[model samples]
Every structure is written in structure tokens, then in C-alpha cells.
Target: AQSVTQLDSQVPVFEEAPVELRCNYSSSVSVYLFWYVQYPNQGLQLLLKYLSGSTLVKGINGFEAEFNKSQTSFHLRKPSVHISDTAEYFCAVEVSTNAGKSTFGDGTTLTVKP
Candidate 1:
């Protein structure tokens, strides 16, 4: 079984500022981690993922995340954020044994002010 947790429920930042959304997970088997962003009422968009290889993974819209094995974490970050970046972010974990099935965190709301 696998589960994910987004440490912060909300994060408010000003435009052009750096931000990080923390996420942690627990699982019995090896897993893949992913970050998704939802803009307003729109569907989720894939931000980044960590299936294998290097610990640092970059995604669309200049977002990136690092997979920490020892800490069991996958935190998303952006060096600079824009007002358009305001949205809800989700962290998910998929067990290697179970394909197409994922456990998602509650989500972290990122509010970027101008």
C-alpha cells in the first residue's frame, strides 16, 4: 500500500518569488512520485514525476522536484512564481506493483499575489 501527504495546506507568495510545496509518502514497496497542478476549475496537469534515474526532476512551467529516498519525500519547487501560477498542487505516489493506481495527497493551495 502507498500513501501521500502534502505538509502544507496553503502557501501564499508574491509574484516573482520562490516557492516550495512539501510532500511526503509512505509505502511498503518501491514507488513513483508525481506532482500535478490544477488551475481553478480545470483538470489536473502533470508538473513532474520521479520514476527512476537522477533525484532531481524538472517539469513544465519551470517547476522541479527532488526525490529523497532516505526522507521519503518529493517536494516541488519553483525559483520564481507568477500570479498565473496560483493553483492547487497535488502529490501522488504509485506503487511499482500496481500500475495505473495512485494515492494522492489532499493538495496544497498556492496563492500568488501580484
Candidate 2:
């Protein structure tokens, strides 16, 4: 079984400020990590992912996350944020097994104010 945990329920930041969203996962075997963003009244979109190879992975909208295998962490970060960046972010983990099972965190609401 795999599970995801988002450390923060909400993060409030002013426009242009840097932000980091912490995420951790637990799994007995290898797993793929992902980050998704959901804007107001919109569907979820993939922000970044960590499947294999490099620990650092980049995604849409200037977002990036590093996979720390030892710590079982995949924290998302951005150098700067804008009002448009305000959205709900979710962390998920997928096991390589064919059971087609995956888990998502409760989500982190990022509020970017001007």
C-alpha cells in the first residue's frame, strides 16, 4: 500500500514570494510520485512527476520538485509565485504493481495575495 501526506493544509504567500509545498509518501516497494494543481472551478492538472532517473523534475507553470528516495519525500517549490498561481495542490503516489492503486494527499491550498 502507498500513501501520501501533505504537511501543510494551507499556505498563504504574497505575490512574488517563494513557496515550498512539502509532501511525503510511504510505500513498501518502488513508487512514482506526482504533483497536481487545480485552479478554481477547474480540473486537476499535472504539475510535476518523478518516475525514474533524475531526482529533480520540472513541470508546467515554473514548478519543480525533487524526489528524495532516502527520505521518501517529494517537495514542490517555485522561485516566485503570482496571483495566478493560487490553487489547490495535491501529492500522489502510484505503485508499480498492476493493482492500479494510487493514493492522493488531502491537498494544500496555496493562496497568493497581492
- How high is the CA lDDT of each candidate model? 0.96, 0.95
Model 2, span 58-109: residue lDDT tens: 9999999999999999999999999999999999999998367779999999
* RMSD (Å) of each candidate, 1 decimal: 0.7, 0.8
Q: After the best TM-score superposition of candidate 2, give how far the Cα of residue 32 lies from its true spot, in angstroms.
A: 0.5
Which regions of candidate 1 deviate over 4 angstroms? Answer: none
Cα lDDT for residue 16, candidate 2: 95
Global fold similarity of model 2 (TM-score) = 0.97
Model 1: ten consecutive residues of lowest lDDT: 27-36
Q: Tens digit of lDDT per residue, candidate 1, span 1-114?
A: 788999999999999999999999999789999999999989998999999999999999999999999999999999999999999999999998998899999999999998
lDDT of 1 at 21: 99
What's the lDDT of the predicted structure labeled candidate 2? 0.95
Give the Cα error of residue 99 in candidate 1, in Å. 2.5
